[model samples]
Target: MYTLLSGLWKYMFQKDEYCVLILGLDNAGKTTFLEQTKTKFSRNYKGMNLSKITTTVGLNIGTIDVGSARLMFWDLGGQEELQSLWDKYYAESHGVIYVIDSTDEERLSESKIAFEKMITSEVLEGVPLLVLANKQDIETCLSVGDIKTAFSDCAPKIGKRDCLVQPCSALTGNGFRLSTEWLEWLLTVLGSNGISCVM
Candidate 1:
């Protein structure tokens, strides 16, 4: 009777869970973005000091509840060696958030290469993609249009997925709310259709 009651309680209250990946080159502010996201969405979550955050060496996990859905974010390390392990989590991910350091003009091409490789994977086909141009608070950072233009060649590889390149600053939390709202709306729509994954 106790077990039955517990199960019933959970089933009635549990939010639909979705896995999201936060991918980008090292120093692209993936961890910072995750922290800011958590701080913003979870009312009682006092996130880490953004300034003290360092490059992710392995993986950082965070969860945020939006409406009836819970988004579980996998913030992976972006170092060259660590990037090889990203695909290991691709099979279970519901969406992908590819972050780019807009201020790093020299590495923009490198970032594009990594993004192209990730999006073209069969496992991630049709998964919703959110491209964040981080560090938008900087005066000289590349605009969203510039990044979109730089990534134009790879658009065909992205297929028919719901993809957007948004300008954001993880440090200042600019554009963060809008991005999460987009995810919430997308997830709600997909959930209503009885689909767990975007495909």
Candidate 2:
């Protein structure tokens, strides 16, 4: 009877949660992306001033529930020194949302190196990666195709993980539609894999 009751309770009210890691190089718009996500999804969320968003020193975390699923996002500092600590959270991450400054052509190579390193980490094996070519509203922003082409060689090195590249603008919210699509995709993956979003 105890087992039966427990099963019934879960069947009636079970929530799926997922841990998402947001990574990128310094000034890559990681924090802004996170804040935008929260503002867009959370209930009655009062948003911060985007222009006031500063570089993260350690981490910023937020949670949002979509249907029966809850997404826990970890926005980590992108400084060169802070990057060494990224591996610490890899084992627990269900997915990765890598933000890139699409308008910053000068740092493309540097960003690629950082991206390659993160996706190639043994701890990140098989984790789904959603690459956001952020700041797309900017005049000089790279197209999603161009960004993909730049990372073409290194992308294949990401193992068997599922990946997607989409354009976004964390500041203007011009590309938030992609964020919705991404969450739906993530939910489908989590369901098929029987992954629990408990962490």
Question: Per-residue alpha-carbon lDDT of model 1 for 37-136, expressed as tens digits?
Answer: 8988899999888999998999999988888778889999999999999999999988889999999999999999999899989999888888888999
The Cα local distance difference test for each model comes to 0.87, 0.87
Q: Model 2: runs farther than 4 Å from truth?
A: 1-7, 176-179
Candidate 2's displacement at residue 127, Å, is: 0.6
Q: What TM-score, computed on C-alpha atoms, does each candidate reach?
A: 0.90, 0.92
Pairs of residues at least 3 apart in sequence or in different chains that clash in candidate 2: 17-197
TM-score of decoy 2: 0.92
Q: In each prediction, how many residue pairs overlap at the backbone (N, C-alpha, C within less than 3 A)?
A: 0, 1
Q: Which candidate tops TM-score?
A: 2
